[model samples]
Target: AQSVTQLDSHVSVSEGTPVLLRCNYSSSYSPSLFWYVQHPNKGLQLLLKYTSAATLVKGINGFEAEFKKSETSFHLTKPSAHMSDAAEYFCVVIGFSGTYKYIFGTGTRLKVLA
Candidate 1:
């Protein structure tokens, strides 16, 4: 079984600065983790994913996350923030509770400041 937790309800970053969103997870086996972003009035979009094949995963819009197995954490980061990056980001994991299913974390709302 696996579950995910988003550590922040909101994160504000200045435009052109770095962005970091924290996430933690628990699983009985090697878990697959994903990051999704949702803009206002739009559907959720997959940002990145960490499967067994990779430790560091890169995603769209300059976003990336590293899987730390020891810490049970997968934190999202971007070197530079754009105003358009303002959105709701969710940390997701698949759980094996009888059947495999998706579990989502409490989303982190990112606000970009001018």
Candidate 2:
């Protein structure tokens, strides 16, 4: 069994400041984790992914995440925040235990301040 939780329901950051969105997961085995972003009325876009290959993974834009096995955390971070970054972010996980089951987080809304 696997589940994911987005630590914050909302996150606000100044235009030139750093952004961080925390996510924690509980899985019975090593699972593939992913981060997706959605605009007001747009589709989900793949932000980044963490497989067995690399603990630190980079994705589109300036976003990046580190897979911490010990802490069971995959937090998303960026050096600077942009108004376009305002959206809903979801944490997803899929465990390879005979089935392709996906668990999704509640999501975190990012608000960018001018």
State TM-scores per candidate.
0.97, 0.95
Instruction: Give all candidates' CA lDDT scores.
Output: 0.95, 0.94
Tens-digit lDDT track for model 2 on 4-109? 9999999999998999999999988888899999999899999999988899999998999999999999999999999899999999999556878678999999
lDDT of 1: 0.95
| Candidate RMSDs in order | 0.8, 1.2
Off by over 4 Å in 2: 95-98
Candidate 2 residue pairs in clash (backbone atoms < 3 Å): none
How far out, in Å, is residue 53 in model 2?
0.9
Candidate 2 RMSD computed on C-alpha atoms after optimal superposition onto the true structure: 1.2
